[model samples]
Target: MHSSTDTGPDDAVGVGAAVMLVEDDRRVRTAVAAFLRAKGFRVAEYDDGETARRAVLDAMPDVLVLDRMLPGLSGDDLLRDIRTRSDVPVIMLTALGASGHRIDGLELGADDYLAKPFALRELQLRIAKLLRHRASRQSPLAPFTVGRFRIDPSLRRITCDGADVVLSGREYELLLFLLKNPDRVVSRDEMLREVWGWNSGDASTVTVHVRRLREKIEPNPREPEYLRTEWGAGYRFTPSGRSS
Candidate 1:
């Protein structure tokens, strides 16, 4: 039941952003929390999944740093719960460095993943990137429609055929990026750079999110009409909902 808040310096880069960090290891949590605080983020630290789950809604964090393993309710279970309730950005931390493990985390709705033994600076950068994305979504852009989907940027809401389509924060960003570039092939690397703010990363991350988006928007994900694979290339989004 360990929890505490560190209000970082007033002028730090991360100032005004709230970050919820759930990690069981005291040593790691303390170190990470301290570093984030120094960078000017309001960090709420938790030592286990169950406690973090209880505090999540109340905290309403800008970004969540969640460990893959935890006592009581596993991180995966907690993530599932979070997804059901909120689209708060999540960055999963795990000891597993395998690509499969990363894909699993991303598939489970994590906005980002960081393998253990990573540099503190890298983690901070990831958090900052997520914060930047969140901030960008708040921009007041005129609502637009492409085919059956209507996107209201001011509300960060999307509806398909007048029915609300719930999407994770990352999912919305990915879909919006594809919609903005309709009828054009967008490489995975380009998606990563433009959507995920990553210069280089596993293409599987983009693949997993694309699959998720298809399941939500396409009547039949097996034969996706909105998002189509380009095999040797990347992906093409068709606003007309027809394979071209």
Candidate 2:
């Protein structure tokens, strides 16, 4: 494992954020770590999945930048393990840019995906956005009820029918966004911008999260009661469970 820090200007968006970066390529890992450090982030670099996994389980980072292909445990396996334990936002890096591969990563619970040979500046921006979202979730807010679901913002917990419903970080955010805009049709582009903090990205990311969220929150995912798709537009959340 390698680490980098700088006494440089701390005005960057990731100033106080600790970033865990795992990549098999020494050159890439070193370069990415150096770049993030210069941007005011404390970076811990690891060369393989197993080492990174141990470190992550020990102390979760603010954000994780993980390569899809790794030495021992492999990126997919590592991500699976991490998701089972924590909701730390993950940005997956891969050489494959195919839509199917991106979808698979999202299904595995990645918050974001970036193809390799990516610009360092883009990576920095993505990290900054994620950090901003993480910070926002901490703000205190009164708990509210929407249909069968009761949301407690302060605790970041949701319960349905008095039973706790487990949701990933991304899923929680998506559900919160929908709950805030009840009965309104929200486009995929809008969801990407508002929820994922992306100006442009594959819409499948939203679709995958929606599917996962429905599985958790909806009694029948096949016929979702709350989250309804508006064909040709996007999605709508009807807290009353009334069919449109």
Candidate 3:
């Protein structure tokens, strides 16, 4: 049976946003997709990692539900592949229950990983929290002046030291979030739920987006003048104007 709550849409959210569901389990896939559709989400179902990967390449979805194991490609492999190109949030669904494997998956770059035999309510809660977090980051409520970067949320534009720096929708959101928080360590979970939405629970989404953000706003994506990694903790943005 389908299970989800808060599927309702208001003036702020798109009622017809498309969600791509990739679960190899036929029964689960059918149930999840139907439930999501009932909640006003447009869903496309895929049964394999490879197919899901291809579909995402063709068109990015508003959300994703990816199974951890697939015949052609391992769920982890597909997760790695997605991170290489986009910061789309991912939540991994797996049958494995080992903490070690879960840790490995997070280290490999998943934003959030959920083992199989899960509850639909838990999944729904996670998805809702993640989407809301992401929307807030992307919204960019006001202009943020950070070091050499000045961001105008209304225009969805950014400039560095007076030079215009173009940003993709994802990049702008990631940068604005980091700048807004400034110097505080923003965890992977925070980035995933707030910046990318919990499409898939792979933390690598945060890394990729941060890397891309650095490339655009930082003086050097390598050294990262503005954005800095806090090792296992997460990341922080120290505006160039801020004194050490």
User: Which 10 residues in a row give candidate 1 its minimum summed lDDT?
Assistant: 1-10
- Model 3 residue 140 CA deviation in Å: 5.2
For model 3, how does the per-residue alpha-carbon lDDT over 89-186 read when each residue is reduced to its tens digit? 56678888787677666544555667878877566565665466556655445777877778887777788788887655566677777777877888
Per-candidate TM-scores read: 0.92, 0.92, 0.62
Tens digit per residue, CA lDDT, model 1, 104-160: 999999989988888777787788777776776677899999887888998878888
Query: What's the alpha carbon RMSD for model 1?
Result: 4.2
171 Cα displacement, candidate 3 (Å): 8.6
Show model 1 residue runs off by greater than 4 Å: 1-12
> How does model 2 score by TM-score?
0.92
Q: Give the candidate number with the greatest lDDT.
A: 2
Q: Model 1: which residue pairs collide?
A: none
